[model samples]
Target: MNTEKFLELLVEELELENPLTLASNLKELEEWDSMTAMLLIGVVSNEFGKTLSAEDIKELTTVQSLVDKIGAQQFS
Candidate 1:
């Protein structure tokens, strides 16, 4: 998927009204919390077929980082 679609999915899933960029800090988002983190793990696995460990997820600080963990090659 492309970056636009990825961002759209995140916004839709998280019910975010603000826009998110690749550099957006995940921890800074109001919608980002422990529950959202868990949701992200499932989203990545189910949508991208990429498995993210708790440690890996913890290391994700930015949207780009999560995209990287999901496999950058998976995006255009």
Candidate 2:
């Protein structure tokens, strides 16, 4: 998926009022709680058809990090 679409999914899943621009930090977002993190993990898995553990989600600090992980999965 394209970056914009990915960001849109993130924003929706996290229930953010503002759009996620490049500078947005995942940890700083108000909705970045455990539940949202789990939701993101599920969303990533569903969208990319890859399985990720909760540990994997905990390790991600930025949206770019998640994107890079998904991109790597495309090659694997």
Cα-based TM-score, every candidate: 0.91, 0.82
Write the residue-wise lDDT of candidate 1 on 1-76 in tens digits.
Answer: 8999999888888778799999999989988888888887887888888888989977989999988777788998
Alpha carbon lDDT of residue 3, candidate 2? 80
Residue-level error in angstroms, candidate 1, position 56? 1.2
Q: Candidate 1: lDDT over CA atoms?
A: 0.87
Number of backbone clashes in candidate 1: 0
CA deviation > 4 Å runs, candidate 1: none
lDDT of 2 by residue, 13-47 (tens): 77888888656778888877888878887888788
C-alpha RMSD of candidate 1 = 1.0
Model 2 regions more than 4 Å off: 72-76
Output the lDDT of residue 41, model 2: 77
Cα lDDT computed for each candidate against the true fold: 0.87, 0.77
